[model samples]
Each structure stands twice: as structure tokens, then as C-alpha cells.
Target: MTLQTTSAERVRTSFDKQGMLRAIGATLTDVRPGSVTIELRPGPSNRQQHGYVHAGAVSAIADTAAGYAAQTLMPEGRTVLTTEFKINLLAPAVGDRLVATGEVIKAGRTLTVAQSKVYALSGENQRLIALLSATLIAVDHVED
Candidate 1:
């Protein structure tokens, strides 16, 4: 795959679209350096016929969190995009809310590698439902 080089380091910036979506209606709740947490409430919109959250939603949240986690370590003028990802659904996502936490594993000159774990949060303990990993590419887009 064709990827951008990580030369001419740029200033770091927040992800506009991502922040907006998460701020408005997205289930994502918290984010920090090398980590993110997303929540998915059990509802008709997010659930399957079997009364469990859809796998796609699980993946989407995990990917977004992982991508943003990678973004947190990039320089200014540089942005991150997920180049590839994989998710392994482990258990039935049956709970009130699903929380996905992502952490960066490797940050390279051109790519950031991260992993996320999805948990079905109960009252006190959480159950592991999915595991996700992604390779994020850093791009320095110039504006005139």
C-alpha cells in the first residue's frame, strides 16, 4: 500500500470529525495518551436481533479509538488514518454498555501500531468481548 512519509514533522492537532462525532452522539467517553474508551449502550440501534450489540459497531468503536490513540502521538500538521485493522469477537456482547480501550504498541516513522480491548461493562467487573489491532499511517497534508 502507498503510504505517506513521516518527514518534515508537523504540528499536532485534534481530530475534528472524530472529536465532533464522539462529542455529539458517539458512545466514546474518554481518551488519553495512547488510550481511548468507547461505550455502547444496549439499545435497538446498537443491538442485534439476539439482544446483543452488533459486531460492526464493536469494530467501528475499537477502530476509531485505536486510530485516535495513534493520533495522540503524532506531530503537528500530521494526521493519522487506519491503514489496516482486525477484530476478534470473543464473547456475547450482552451488557448495559460496551467499553473499548485502545493502547499504542509501536510508533514508527510512518506507522503506528495499536491494540484495543472491548469489554462488556457490568456493575463492577467487565467481561472481555473483543480484541482489535490496527496499523495507523501518519500523513502530513500541506494546506496552501
Candidate 2:
């Protein structure tokens, strides 16, 4: 298999181990070098009292997307974890589904900076609902 294909597969494998994402119904939609996208359907389980997608759900997907984006660039023995992140909720996430797209801004030997933009999609309209900036660190994989 090509390196790119292998890289995406690695991400998918790691993402499958995330219980929070599965609990909130998040799915990996696209995975590429330095970029990844996650999708979540806004339902009663994930919505706030206002009938909009909860901010925590939005943050979780964005954080995971950004963390996985950084992981895509690491070597086989390394894994990435979020060290810090800041999220801005620009608009209410009231839609059919939420899409978070993350891309690496700067990748260093130990730390990688990534950003995720979350959009709420309703019918034919898509609105930018949140923006997240995250820092991730590459560390040796721990035995499971």
C-alpha cells in the first residue's frame, strides 16, 4: 500500500479507540496528510437545552480531529496527544450535522500546532460555528 493510504489507515485505527467520539456519534469522514475531518449528527443525545448541538460535543470532535491531524505526520512508533487547545464558539450549532475539519499549521520535532474549523450543515446551508487552535505533542506509544 502507498504511504498515504497507510497513514490514513493508522489514523482510522487510533480513532476507533476513542470512546468519547463513539459515545457522541462522531465519525471520521476524511483523512489526509496534515488534515482530517470528523462528522457528527446533532441529535437529542448531543444537543443542549436550546436544541442546538452542545458546545462540549463540538469541542470534542474538533479536538480529536486536530489531534489526529498531528498524528498523521508522526512516525510509526510515535503518537500525538493534545497538550493545549482554545476554542471559540462563533455561532450556535443548530443543524442536521456538524463537520469539523482540522489542518496542521506548524509541525515541529516534538510539538505540532493544528487548527480545526467546525461547521453546522443544514439542508443546503453550512455555517461556521466554531474554531479551535490546538497544540499536540508527539510521544512514544504506550503498550496497551
Candidate 3:
């Protein structure tokens, strides 16, 4: 398979293991060498007052996308963990779905920095809802 295909598959497989991502109805939509996209439909449990997507759900998807973006660049047998993150909720997350696009800012042997921009999608329009900056660490994976 091509690198893009392999990367996408790897990210999707790892993303499937995330309970919170699944709970919030987020799915891995795209993956490349240094970028990934996650999409979510805000369900009843994902909303806060005013029937908007909660900040926690918004940040969770963004953070998870960032980690997967970094993971795409790591060597085999390696995975990523978020060390720190900062998210800015630019607008109310009120739409049919939310899409978080994550891109690697810098990739290093042990640490990586990435950013994710979350957008609320309605019909043919998408609005910026949140921005997330994250730092992640590469670690060896041990399968059980």
C-alpha cells in the first residue's frame, strides 16, 4: 500500500481504541503523513446548555486528532500521547457536525507539536469553532 493509505489505516485502527472518541461520536475521517481529520456529530450526550456541543467534547476530538496526526509520522511500534494542549473556543459549536483538522507543526524524535482547527459544518458551509495546539510524546507500544 502507499504511505498515505498505510497511514490512514494505522490512524483509523488506533483511533478505534479510544473510548472517549467513540462515545462522543467522533470518527477518523482522514489521515496523511503529518495531518489527520476527525469528524463528529454532536449527540444528546455531547451537548451542553443552549443545545450546542460542549467544550469538553470539542476539545477532546481536537486533542485526539492532534495525537493521531503525530502518530502518523512515528516509526512502527511507536505511538503518541498528548503531553499538553490548549484549546480556544472561537464560536459556539452548533451545527450538524464538527470537523477537526490536525496538522503537525514540528516532528521530532521524542516530541511533536500539532494544531487542530475545529469547524462546525452545516450543509455546504463550515464555520471555525475552535483551535487547538498540542504537544505529544512518542512512546513505544506494547500490545497485549
Candidate 4:
């Protein structure tokens, strides 16, 4: 695993120490200069109608990915929060694990834009689960 410097690492570190990351069952898979990947497996509690992963769950994954991707480009000690996002459910969530890959398209002083694609690993083939576009804003928090 290559951990290229991430702008949000400082914030993620604090969040990790506070055990907030565990709430979503998310962990960093790959963190690099402009890209980030977050992995999650839909457990029993994440299922919705028809015994499949809920759309809400999928949306959360995308949001996480996009936020982290944006964070990778910010200055150290800065944290990012989602400002706006839009997601399109491309296909059914049919897989053992869901991988959300996000890349920063634009990074600015206050706002960042990211694009994400979610894939479900189904045996030998990967299926497209969702597509997301999001904007995040970097903020300074006094709480340490």
C-alpha cells in the first residue's frame, strides 16, 4: 500500500483517534496524491428491500470517497466537509464488497470537486453500482 501524502490525513488521524471512522465501517484502502479509495461490505444491517444493499448505503460510500479524495489535495491540518453532491445509481448492488474510488478534479482555496465511481466485485466480474459528483469545503475546527 502506498500512502502518498493526503491533505486530510491530519484530520482523518484525529477522526480515527475519536473512532468516528468506525461508525461507517469504512477504512482507507489507497490514499495517494489525488485519489482515494474507501471499502465497505454491506452487512446484515445495510440491506434494504429485496435483500440487497440499500441505496443510502451506496450513497454514503460515494460521499466518503469524494470527501477523502478532496482531502488529499488540501494543506496539512485541514479538514473537509461535504457541501453538495449528486449520485446516479447505475446498476443493482450485487457483489460481495463495494469499492468506491474518488479522484479530485478541482482543488481550490475553499472548495474542491471530486468524481467517484462505485464498483461491486461479483465473482470474476466487477459491476458498476453508482456514479457520484461532489463538492467539499475545507474547514478549520478548533477541537483537537
- For all predicted structures, in order, the TM-scores are 0.79, 0.96, 0.93, 0.85
Q: lDDT of candidate 1? A: 0.73
Could you tally the backbone clashes for each prediction? 6, 0, 0, 0
In order, what lDDT does every prediction score?
A: 0.73, 0.92, 0.90, 0.78
72 in model 4: Cα distance from truth in Å?
1.2
lDDT tens digits by residue: candidate 4, 1-144 = 124443445535643653434654666677677777877787766678787778887888788778877877776557788999999999888688889999999999898999999999977889888999999998985466
Decide which is better by TM-score, 1 or 2: 2
- The list of candidate 4 runs beyond 4 A from truth reads 1-24, 142-144
Error of 3 at 3 (Å): 4.0
Compose the digit string of candidate 2's lDDT tens values, residues 1-144.
Answer: 488788899899888888989988999999999999999998877888998889999999999999989988988888988999999999988888899999999999899999999999999999999999999999998654
Clashes of 2: 0
Q: What is the lDDT of residue 119 in candidate 3?
A: 97
Q: How accurate is candidate 4 locally (lDDT)?
A: 0.78
User: What residue pairs are clashing in model 2?
Assistant: none
Between candidates 2 and 3, name the one with more favorable TM-score.
2
Q: Which parts of model 3 have CA positions greater than 4 angstroms off?
A: none
Candidate 1 regions exceeding 4 Å error are 1-25, 141-144
TM-score of 2: 0.96
